[model samples]
Target: MEKISNFLEQSRMKDYILKTKLGESSLSTVWKAEHRTTGEAVALKQIPVAKLTRHLKNCLECEITFLSSVNHPNIIRLLNFFECEGCIILVMEFCAGGNLASYIRRRGRVQECMAKRFMQQLGAGLKVLKQNHVIHRDLKPENILLSCSECNPILKIADFGLSRILLPDESAETVCGSPLYMAPEILQFQRYDEKVDMWSVGAILFELLNGYPPFHGRTSVQLLQNIKESTSLPFSHLVLPELHPECMDLCSRLLSINPDDRLSFEDFYQHNFLRT
Candidate 1:
């Protein structure tokens, strides 16, 4: 805590003006800044460098390291990094369009064509990460960011606090993610692989069609049970012919209860829905 406090105290705008606070959570704070020289705007995330438990601090460092190494059009770009006092500040490209979760809430369920576009871009981003041996444990609407007003609202995966780089033989044991989006394997608390991410994509696809998550309850336990048992009854079966069969097919394969039975990237890419 002392390190973070000192870092905050030392923070000074190098070439930008602090406009306003965008958001805040327990771990970090976000600010909108306008570059003084370039006249460009960006989002600045300030992470406490000190006083964090060693585990959390290592996590933050991991995110920084990963972001620095990886780059893709659909992924959020890290613009700058600096240390102030005991705080570490990351300046990132700002996406004025906001996250997909808030976007969906305001616009309601998106069109099948539009949702497919999002899924393709999201898959592209995931492909890059998986090729690098990084598995994003949290894959949900909130993490996807829009690119611009005119271009396809590209999905930029962000927030890597729960993410870990998987070793060749290493399998993840820790089960952590939003309950509604958790894969069957994850809820079981068993050692799992990258397939958990596929399950999340499936859940997101289902929500895109139905305007709400497939699983729901007043509490966490109920939500988990819903995921465990609700796999066979798809949201598509309820909507039926009203919804495109192609879209429904994609969702069904994505939401498969068994990770081994889920669609592979090759299969997903080959789907006619995306080709169209």
Candidate 2:
């Protein structure tokens, strides 16, 4: 932690301007910044030291270690890290095209082919992380970023705040992920692994095709019950009813209530919707 802070102090990047605020969650604020020396833009994620618990501080340190090991075109790049006042600032490549969540909110429903393209890009990014034995506990649309142009949205998975690096023989038993897209096993607090991410991908795909998730309710308990007991809507019932049955069937298998039954990443990649 001290080394990271010292390294940022020595960089001496000059003439920086705060372009705008990119995003804000409960614990951190993301800002868009420009580098005067290299004439490049970057995303600056700032987390206050005062606001961090010991656990959160450890998580932040782990995040730095994880980012250092990750490098992929479809994954957001962590350019640098620095300390300002009492805050830890993580400098990253700015995704000007915004996040997938914002895009979905703006356009209601995306075209089937376009949704598949984004999922393929997401899967490709996940493949890299999986190869490194990392799992992004949170895989919702909000964490998936886009490139600068709307014409070609380069999907890059962002926000490693909830991610974990698994050891070769280890399994995660803690339940931590977005409830809306969480796998049933996670809700039940059962031991789980990388397959939870596959369930989330299936949930995102369902929303992309049907314009909403399979489970909807006014309360958290209701939502949990829905997810635990819901049956997937067939592809034929989607807005684009012409979508191949194989595509919908794959979605069903991916979103299965039993995590043991969910599609593995390799099988998901081989599905006709993605392979086609």
Model 1, 54-73: lDDT tens per residue?
76676677777888987898
lDDT of 2 by residue, 180-250 (tens): 88877887778888898998999888777766766766765777787766555534344756566776777
Q: Which 10 successive residues of model 2 have the least lDDT summed? A: 229-238
Q: Give per-model TM-scores.
A: 0.88, 0.89
Q: Which parts of model 1 are misplaced by more than 4 Å?
A: 1-12, 149-151, 231-239
Compared with the true structure, all predictions reach lDDT values of: 0.78, 0.80
* Residue pairs in clash, model 1: 1-51, 7-86, 7-87
Residue pairs in steric clash, candidate 2?
none
lDDT of 2 at 40: 89
